[model samples]
Target chain A: MLFRNILFFMGESWKNLFRNGWMSLASIGVVAVTLFILSVFVLINMNVHHLTEVIEQDVEIALYIDEEATSDEREQLVENLRNHPEIKKADFVSKEEGLERLRDQLGEENGLLEGYENPEDNPLRDAYEISMHDPEAVSSVAREIETYPAVGGVEFGEDVVENLFDFTGVLQVTVMGLMVALALTATFLISHTIRLTVMLRKREITIMKYVGATNWFIRWPFLFEGFNLGLLGTVIPLVGIYFGYESVLQWIDANLKFFPSLIPLETAMGQVIILVVPLGMALGIIGSLISMGRYLKV
Target chain B: MIEAVNVTKKYNDGNQALKKVSFLIDRGEFVFLVGQSGAGKSTLFKMIIKELVPTSGTLKVFGRDVSRLRGKEVSVLRRNIGIVFQDFRLLEEKTVYDNIAFAMRASGASPREMRKRIPQVLEQVGLKKKVYSRVNELSGGELQRAGIARAISNRPAMIVADEPTGNLDPQTSMDIIKLLRNINVKGTTVLVATHDQQIVDELKKRVIYLEEGRIVGDQEKGAYVRAL
Candidate 1:
């Protein structure tokens, strides 16, 4: 009996959907546009994170060892730094290599150095270029490395690391705020749509109530209708997200070839597909339920 | 069997729709409640069906106190007490068959039972041939028959019809009264609220007359009496 009623309910709900074709389309359109905007926000947020990570990878701490340190001591210091959980990579840079790099940077400005003694006479200590696992981890790792007797000084762009961290924090907050606002807007729009639909069926509902149909029996089909509308709305936006993410990645790859390790468009697309469908359906169901709550009482 | 003990109903606007109305209707008996507009015939019908709670009196229908019924209990009570509206309250979007089937479904009738019983009810109401006809396509008389078919689809213990024949032709009205009488003879209590003097005089069944939300007369085989 329950199964049969469910079937009949679903059939009736579908008929209602077709009967109110333009209204259903309008509701679905609202859902689709809202989900599309939400998906775009998600994609942009992910890509921004990817870009920031790339920039973070390039900022590293340079640790200069004491001049009196032996090769073995220096090797031990390098090994210790490598084993540190915060360090991504560590390599030794000899004094000669550092002098050569400085000279390369000062090319064609040798006139300023002509009257001065040979810059190589005061050989700088061997230094270890250590990339931390994350830009934020640099300060703490540098402090730990400073405790080593073989280490003289540590240098890294603290301001850049702080700026990157702050940027990510602000992005997260903004995304959260935008998501909450969009969710409220979606709820308002979808609920009003359902309210209008319920108003149109007010007589039918009143008659059903007169005929002794339970609250659940009358409510289930309408709720399912809303869920179906939401699901339908999700289809177009999901497909659009997939194609849009791919096309944007393609454009970036073709035009901005300098940036490497861009986030895979497929991964971002998958995330959006996973998130938007449930969100849309939840909004739809909640909206329908709220409207039904008022109108079904009769 | 239905019984009201001094039932009273007052609307929010301070209009008293039913005022200390009391009556008893025996099982398997047909009764006519006659009154002019705003005389509380509909209010009495609403009370019997538990659609409106009395302001200060008890109403018992089919051994249940309708005055106190709520939630699933009200639905359960309604399942055994069919109601027909004067407007024929059929779902216009549904076919005659679906309209009757919906009544059975709401009462939790099994599909097998529905399959066997829906056709039988439609046949009883002479709507067997028009079972699949949409309500909008049916004539005023046919629609009334469809409404009757839906009312009796569940074989309810009692049927409360408010102005069932008001919109039908004289012959169609007689046909509807005869149909209700037939169902009453078959053991379902039937209550018809109408002011059709011709039908009331012709049928000569028990009559309860209401005037200004109060029963002014009760008679056996009565004529329609106009009371202000």
Candidate 2:
């Protein structure tokens, strides 16, 4: 009986597909477009999260020491900074190295420094370039470094780091909101499509009822129709998402060489494909079920 | 067996289709409900299938009270009672064989049983050659036979046909009535709602005559005696 019902359902769904050809086409088209847009939004949101995390991992705070401290005291402070639990890596940049870095940034504009007395004569503090286990732990680490007698002050740009973190938070919330809105709109479109399909088959359903068909028997075909629509709709968008992710990855790899590790294109593609098929099926099944529940009662 | 005690159905628009009407039909009996267009014949038929509830009354079919049945119980009741509509209501897109098989499948019949019984039912209805024919391609008589095949496919204990030959000619009407009589002879209670005086007079079966939603006459082996 179960096997017969399944075969009957498949056959009926196929018949309905042909009988309501234009409407079925419209339904499938709507499902495909809505799912495509939703998949794109998910891909964008995930990529943004990946990019933010990569940038966060690269941000480090630099702590400079007081010029009055003796060489040995400065060395001790450097050792202490390296041993801190939060510190991933800590290296001291001598005053000469700092001046050299400034010179390189100034380029040929170093002619302005020629009028000054020996650049080495100017008092400059040695700085520790510190990388921490977590970007969020930077402030506490800075405080600890400031208590050292040899340290002049922590010199990391607190405002810049805080603003970057805040920007990423806002971006995450905005993406989440957009994702929800897209999903709702997709569901609504799919639902409307399925409802139209039901309307087209109303007469056929009434006849089925009078012919002694059970409610589930009448419902199975339409459920299968919805499942097929959802599955078909996911195909194009999943392919588009794959190519889109690859293009973005290629652009980042070529242009943003300074950015730390990029997410591999294959991994992103695999995840998108995994997520899209089920999402498509869910949308299809849910839309069809809702429409059928309201209209197939007879 | 079918029995109704003071069954009443009042539409929401203040139209009382059947008002405290009562009747009884025995197993293997061929009965006719004769009435005018607005005289509640269809309402009584609908009530028998539990499609419409009586405002206040009791209806028992095969010894089970239909008024208290719900969900699957109602469906099960329907499965045991075959119903034919005035419009035939055949799935126009399906072949005759498929339509009959659909009924069997809905009642949860096994495939082996369906394969065995469908051909037998088709031959019984004299449509063995037209089994693969689409309903839209069949004549009025052939379509009615297909409808009969579907109604009787599940071997229901009772068959309720509302205007089974409403759209056929006089000759076709007799053939359809003869088919119903044959089904009746097979021990399935048959209740037909019609105004064909010729058929009623010719069959001379039990007739329940109605006027203004009230039974005016119910006689054993009676003829059509009431006029509009």
Candidate 3:
């Protein structure tokens, strides 16, 4: 019995969708545009979040080791840093390696620093670059590392980290608010579109009501119609997003190298596809339900 | 089968469609609710089908107070009382067979039952040959017959047809009236609201006459009596 009704409603829904061709197209058009806009926002938000995470991961406190300190003391300091739960990794950089890094950075400018290249005259310090698993803990870790007697100095980009945190926080809130507003607007548009379709069939609906059809009996086909429309609307966006995302990613990689790279398509595409289809269907269903409430009142 | 006690319906615009009307329609009786246009005949039909609620009275059908019925209960009440509109109200795209079958399908009758009952109802309404024809292709009388078939397909206890033959020619109207009479003979209570005085006088069934939303005359085997 249930199976029969499912087929009946499905068939009726399909018929209604096609019978009113222009209206159905109009409905699908609205849904597609809404979903496309929503997908664009999601992609932008996801990339922005990814960029923030990358910047946060780069925050590190550099603890300058005392030149006279013994290797055992250095090892003990490393052990102490690692014992702190917030410290992700503490790697020691010797003065020689630091000097080599400076030379690489200077490139042709190394000639200017030739006099300071001698091992006896080397001014670079042996330091531990302390990485924190939680970026918010960077200042606390820097303060704790400063108490070490063997530490000559502690340095990190405190102002840069704070600004980045504040900016990302605001961006996240704004992105979330935009997504909610877009969802509501999309639902409302879809409902209005479906309501037009319902209005066109008002006579059939009134006749159905007169002939003893239950509210669900009258409602299910329309609901299915909305679901199908939503599913149809998702098609263009999914095609655009799935195939388009890679090209956009490649373009960014080629032209926008200075900006942090977006999350790989392989990593991000799955989440997007999962979200878009269901969201599209939900919008369609909600819109149809809202329209159905008016007609079913007899 | 149906009872209305002092049922008064005041519209949102403050127009009173029915004023303190009281009547009881017994089971298996054919009734003619004769009235002029705007005499509240349509309103009374709407009330009987539970489409319109009485403003301040108890209206019951099948022993349930319809004015207080919930959404689900309304459909149940409607299932037992078939309603036919003057417009024929058939889905023009659907065939005559599908039109009648549609009603059976609404109440969740099995396909086998639908297949069996649909032809029977169409035959009962004398539309056996027009079963596969689309409703738009049918003439005025044929469409009305299909509408009546759809109404009686569920074997309802009562059939409330509001101006069923209002759009038909006099000859065709007589045919449709006879079809309804046959269904009444088969034991369904039939209530027809019409303004055709010739047919009303000819049939001479019990008549309740209305004028300006008030019942002015009630007679057994009544003739059509126009108000002065």
Per-model lDDT: 0.80, 0.79, 0.83
* Residue A115 lDDT, candidate 3, scale 0-100: 84
TM-score chain B for all models. 0.95, 0.97, 0.97
TM-score of every model?
0.80, 0.81, 0.77
For candidate 2, give the DockQ.
0.35
lDDT of 3 at A95: 88
Q: Please give the lDDT score for candidate 1.
A: 0.80
Query: What local lDDT does model 3 show for residue A100?
Result: 88
Docking class of 2: acceptable
| Model 1, C-alpha of A87: deviation from truth (Å) | 9.7
Regions of candidate 1 where Cα sits further than 4 Å from its true position: A44-58, A61-161, A173-175, A251-270, B226-228
Q: Sorted on TM-score, highest at the top, how do the candidates line up?
A: 2, 1, 3
- Native-referenced TM-scores of chain A, all candidate models: 0.63, 0.66, 0.63
Q: What DockQ values do the models have?
A: 0.46, 0.35, 0.57
Q: What TM-score, to 2 decimal places, does chain A of model 1 have?
A: 0.63
Better of 1 and 2 by lDDT: 1
lDDT of 2 by residue, A158-241 (tens): 565466568757866876676567656556655666676678777667656654567787788888877877787788777777
- Top candidate by lDDT: 3
Candidate 2 local lDDT, B159-221, one digit each (tens): 999999899999999999999999899899999999788889999899999888998889888
